[model samples]
Target chain A: MSKNYSDLNLIVRSLLPENQETPISFLPEDHLQTDLFFRRNHFTYPSLTNSSYWLPIVGAVHTPILFSFKDLVQMPSHTVKVVLECAGNKRNLFKPKVFGEQWEKGALSMGRWKGVSLKTLLNVTGLKHDATEVVAEGYDYGNRTDIDHTFSYMRSLPIEKALHPDTIIAYAYNDKPIPFKHGFPLRLIVPQWYAMASVKWIKQIRIINKKFHGPFQSIDYVYYPQKESDAGAYPVTYNRVNSIIQQPLNREVLDTGLHIIKGIAWTGKGTISKVELSVDHGETWIRAVIDRPYNANYEWINWSYEWEISKKGEYTLMAKATDSFNRTQPPEAMWNRKGYGYNAIDTVVIKIE
Target chain B: MSKNYSDLNLIVRSLLPENQETPISFLPEDHLQTDLFFRRNHFTYPSLTNSSYWLPIVGAVHTPILFSFKDLVQMPSHTVKVVLECAGNKRNLFKPKVFGEQWEKGALSMGRWKGVSLKTLLNVTGLKHDATEVVAEGYDYGNRTDIDHTFSYMRSLPIEKALHPDTIIAYAYNDKPIPFKHGFPLRLIVPQWYAMASVKWIKQIRIINKKFHGPFQSIDYVYYPQKESDAGAYPVTYNRVNSIIQQPLNREVLDTGLHIIKGIAWTGKGTISKVELSVDHGETWIRAVIDRPYNANYEWINWSYEWEISKKGEYTLMAKATDSFNRTQPPEAMWNRKGYGYNAIDTVVIKIE
Candidate 1:
């Protein structure tokens, strides 16, 4: 049975229900439940058959290659633990609140993905010198108010991001076949960018001589700064620094005494350098102990701080993260028309009795 | 009519309302309106008589002196514009929401004060070599739950801060007699610390032989870091870095066009080195234009950023300030039980339609 997209009541809906949010508190575990991984689809699931399928490669190439699923897996396969977050995560917190799924930091999840490296596939197909962009298109089609006609979900990446060794065309998740709701037989995973860049139900790869101007590429997912014309807007790329408080949820009443505060921090640009906590409404901050043994370049790090509370009153708990590149989460998330990349400091209020 | 203390539903009310908030947007001006200046009192306003009144100078002094107001103004009065902010400003933003007035950035103001330097008064009284702290007492009296017995509002400062040239006993505000509500006749002004350190309606000054242990000084306004017991909390001092966006208040809707975003930035530690704006949800940031001619070592500097909006959508505007000492506003304010010294980056969201 097909699900009605209207039933989801998502903040942003073009093709499929923007469902799937990971229960982040269960993290620090080696593998996330396959059902709990975030799923962002641009179209309804396409019907599948036992017949073999091929991925077509066209444009700016000396010779285009149409490789079957068997052909991709025959080449050396690589496995990686990657975390994916919707660009619009935490969009509900924006003042005046932007449009899209009003996600409150749950639109993210981690998975152990098994895939064939894009670089390996690129090495097999000879590319022309002028090929500057790699356009990836999905088979799903949908109507978008931002564009004129029904179009398939498609996006393009620069040659550098496309050729990155970590970029992959995946066939399995958590050592199992990719779930039908998540993309079925195949999907593209661009580890660093927002989940939107990792096209789902991917069908064709086209190498272009110049920047691609698809609606999703040019008009949508672009950064329109205040007063700047849309023509000059920059395309959204890497994720910013962000952190979340997992223990003692907001407004949780507790006894006036010592308590342990904990949370997780992550960023797409670099490793988290430090995490800090503020228990007295941002009057003074102290460093939190980050669990370093399980830290990974792409996975979130767990951190904790012990706080002693003798006074019975309300307290606002806050967490901030700084990346190795000296980039820190902003006190407030930057605002974009599409609500992309909202990574402000995380806050939660609780009462002590 | 005397107002009963119970009538005031204040977050931090004991002997007095503990109420005072500067109208921040009217700042950077040469003189703030007398009515708009923040007024924090620890007790009911004490009626003043024209008959000879003296400010008693006692404790660790070779010769105790009772100098009248006339004697203070006679010592070459100096006038300066200094900004005073309640240390607990923006305390409401902390997660768990700590106690004290849930101030949202309006507990500060600038005033042109006419007074005699504390150093001049100290020189006349002849401080003993053992004198290490100067405790200032206000005439207003009240009961206390934090301590035993009815105590006058009193706070002590280290000799260094007490003897600083900027520290003064002010006789007038804005070239006029100080209003009754705002410490009429005379008040102590400690230029750099939070308003609580500046005792209001002053009547006595006592130089101590050692560190003072008054309720307000050693207990109330102290910093208690995560691991520290209440007994080990540090006394609150010097204000932290802070900024505010006065124009285009949060959630303001405007037409899609060019608009100038303006605000004020100030720090007690040093001059503002830079101010940056992020309109793309902090994915990228650019330097804002700081109004330079009005810049003063002790006053806030006005800043403006030109934003051109061509897209009709929601946007979150953020501002981050850095000081000459390399201290930047944290992504989240530090938290203290008293909710003091919140200096997180300022953020606002608006819709362009």
Candidate 2:
């Protein structure tokens, strides 16, 4: 407990890239990506596995070839804004029905993703005609079976999405190089999509002329439509519109004077068009003032509102958002079979004097 | 590098609370306050030294006594949500002229501050009627003769504000308890005020009838009002009405479709009454929907909007907020002598197809 701060820093530096320094001070209280909980379980594969990752291209539009680390560094680099959300996010809301990590909305973040376009990387290697799916593999230990299995982390995407110029085999973050825990060396960035597609510690990429199948791609990380139909299930693709209340959670409070309410919102397929706030349990709606332009496609937008209270009282507050396409944040929590994508309307209660 | 997930978990169990048994996966991200920068140069004074911290209470108050943790916790308990912000946040906005820590907005955070009321805490020991100023001391390394050479951290408040029921000697955070990195078992939490007043690693709480003097008490953490005389200086107190662009700093481009913009807004004194958004770079104003109640006095509120782009073009977006008292976010950053309390309007650029 009395360890030197420098010694702890040395341990962090030994495990991560020295070039990707964030002053350790930038990590906010709500920001937990650097907490020991997440860091403790990271890098086990890269630190212990003997097998290095490889980038292989075998698809319809690109040349088929196996690329090495030297080959990856040789590709042209491109940068884009992307937000990554863990598939198990908001799992705490599911309770008895859900089975996964109990992550509170902290499993997401926005960063300037930097790397070579996966499309370009594929084009460098020859592609087989008629390919439709692109598969990515990781070094995370997976048991191949459930009981004693290692965490299997792999997923595939349609060639169309994979071939997009913005989609990249990410190598850097915030303009600087990335730390290994954040998928150093190489990883994939599928903007506006779940993080499962952005495989970490990537070791291989395969393009298939036939449909690619995997547990993560099929049974897991998939978004089942609200109406489960006989037409077969649609895979979880683009992210849905969502927002989270950053204030008045459990430990924060407002002063007994004029104040403002604030939070973040975003969508995968469209832009956020409107965010409605209510103080009386969504009984009435007031338009909040938007603070910034819709800057990133995948990144959440910041927002706020002005309110006055002359006396002391207790009240419940709620916020719900809608996208440009007229899709509003669901008032009720949606029922996802896997309890994923819980972008329901968030609520908070406060007492003021 | 190839460590087992289970093995890594074991390490965590040893460092964090083991008796609480809050399931390995049920941990909340922001609950832990440990961070590398805060851990640096941690004070481990076994006995009194030159770098000693003091907590003085003055003003229309009673029960005035300078007591250590051994006495502070002996009083009753009270809990409230309080956010502490370093006066130097966003200082890089005015580089060179300022000589202080270059902290982003991350230095601020909300916590469930728990401790005895400064009033109650003082009453238990004793009080010298007629005190008006409550000064605090910190163990920052500095020269005793040179006021500027005082500790790197410190702040003071009016006695009334110091003894407000909402304010307390915080010893617990987010429930459970406080770690050494976050003021350990005792510290001050002056709701709605900046974090400087919430000195960490508290040592003594003294109650006196005269105004206290210290380098941190008079010279540092002072902010001058724009309308007030620049020659005169006043200690910075109440927080201002402000909001931040939490996402889409570099607007993302999605395939022609609906989109949503989101962000957070907050005020120091009361609930926010209105948040006005301008998509045309402040040229036009539109009301956004607020997501929560305006009652919380210290936490942030989430707000957002949606915009549809049928044609491709370049656009500028801006967000401005007004509080209950008609206090609005400034369109431009203010010219602060010390570059503190930056609540200027936030803007961003976006391209749509």
Candidate 3:
């Protein structure tokens, strides 16, 4: 699901110099790193923690089972390198004007998502054929919970993603139980898509024959294409091909000699196979060395290329990533009513004297 | 758009009495008046005052326009009646085995939304033509604000809505400037739709021609048909033919003779033309009298019907509304992946022994 500011008129009251339009690849270390909650337009983090957490299943499922923290702790865990890309990852790419966090590129991050397979847990509970959809609710309260809004933090995955052996109900990340900020006790981790599908602090897993329809499932995360036609209005999926020039974005120009063009590449579906760097405005493309492949699922891979600038006048650096599926980053992303899955290749310019 | 919670699995923490579903319709006196938010969900009301506020215009906009309380209050203002309805207003209707708020209607409300028109303000300032979408960000500081998430209160509307004449950049409600509890200083009051569009404590408005793709817009407010087509999905809009029987849901039995079946009917489009009551499931219908029409566009209108029940068994009283355009409520709503626009002819069971 994605977040869009539909009913708001923002006026910049006061912004620190840095909060202004200074571009970079990743979110600055000092800046706040928050989740992209659609219902809530601001970055929100969990302030409290439930000492115990679990993935409870009910409805058409065989027997209702609540997998507690202890049970999750005992389960076999695997670490998968995946990129948690907010559906609106590159919202900043749109030129002239755009609504949303000027999410230049940082919205997409590669992390070792640590969790247990949901397939394993459902198998342990005994699967039910009648279950057509698996409704998963999050631990976080809905944005306007205080306002009597009934929507809980929830969405449904077809039985397919639920049954995917790789789709894990993760309890740990980077070899440890995730910090409270990243869905500590238990989270459903689905690689290859945005972070929303990986419901954090998951408490319930409903197996239902009927399609799930609630606020979080129907309205919040879905995206409309820019074009009015049905062809463009597909629900966002698969991170698009996008790469960023990480090193310098009009930052202070320390003696510009042999500059190392460094950046990150990611795709929504498969592993990024190649990352090509372009200087002189896509006029020339040089193959950047791909870092070791992250897990086969949905995560980002780092890539870098060395540029020898004998004498630099002005340089525009761009990076494009190709996923295993062979989809390369488009120069201009497909226009969508909702700016989602924006994996267009990113370009950064540097003026060198 | 809206928030979808299909995937969420909430344990029945505490169950309301089965027969104690909140009445669907009630007098203004019965608008579920609550001085404080329910504690079950720990959420605080956002500070709407300008001293505690800031608005930033980030993407695609000609120039990012940031505002403080001083700036917003400084802009021009207008008055309009906006009826805000949470997407989950009739969530409780998904009975039998539905997992949601189980809201017995009542989630809808009409209020004077006051705000400055973003387009007017931007036009005065000159937004770029490329700016097609507007993201309205809010200052809703919730428990989960620290994660790398998007803002808590956010929604994206097409620039069309932002520029509409009726759309206002509001700083007041009902001639009085807002109180902190009610989006102080300013809030966006979008006419003709549910209240979710009236984002409270708004902070920033980003403009971009590109789609404002985020979890909220894509996954949340979107509706999918029961059938998946090769094409794409549909967007949920307008309140459908909906009404609630104001009094005597399950508590007391009406004495035989004359009783008033009072309720309210509303739609996203035109005015309420006729409200009919059905005493026998839907076998027969009678016209119910509307008290008076709300002058604003399509805000909810109050209505009541006098029924002389000479004889009664298990009386199933139903009500349906027709709009000014002659759109009538259907007996059954079209089935979709998300149960949106469920304006099906309502059935209210009343017994007179």
lDDT scores in order = 0.74, 0.60, 0.60
Cα error, residue A244 of model 3, in Å, equals: 1.5
lDDT value, residue A142 of candidate 3: 36
Model 1 alpha-carbon drift over 4 Å, by segment = A1-353, B1-20, B23-31, B293-295
CA-only RMSD, every prediction: 19.8, 19.2, 20.1
Error (Å) of candidate 3 at residue A71 is: 1.3
> How does residue A92 of candidate 2 score in lDDT?
56
| lDDT, candidate 3, B123-152, per-residue tens | 755777687777776676443212334336
| lDDT per residue (tens digit) for residues A1-353 in model 1 | 22221111111112133344554543434546565565555445555664777888888887899989999889999876677888877776877565555465667877777889887888888789998989999877776544447888899999889898888899998889888767757788888688888887778999999878888888778876544456446888887888999766664556666898998888887789999899887888899999863547777778999888889777889999999999988887777766788888898887776
Give every prediction's interface RMSD. Answer: 17.6, 16.8, 24.5
TM-score of chain A of each: 0.91, 0.81, 0.81
Most DockQ-accurate candidate: 2
Provide candidate 2's TM-score on chain A.
0.81
What does DockQ give for each predicted structure?
0.01, 0.02, 0.01
Better of 2 and 3 by DockQ: 2
Give one digit per residue, the lDDT tens place, for model 1 in B1-353. Answer: 22122211111211134354543542333436565565555556665665677899999888899998889878978776777888777876776466555566667777778899988888998999999999998888875544447888889999998998989899999889887777878889888688888788898999998878877787678876542357546778888878898656565556666898888888886788899988866668889898853546767777898999899777878888898899998888877666778888888777766
Could you tell me every candidate's TM-score relative to the true structure? 0.50, 0.50, 0.45
Tens-place lDDT per residue, model 2, B94-207, is 522343333334444545677878767666654556666665544434333222233545455677887788878777777766665566656677877766677765555554
Judge the docking of candidate 3 as incorrect, acceptable, medium or high.
incorrect
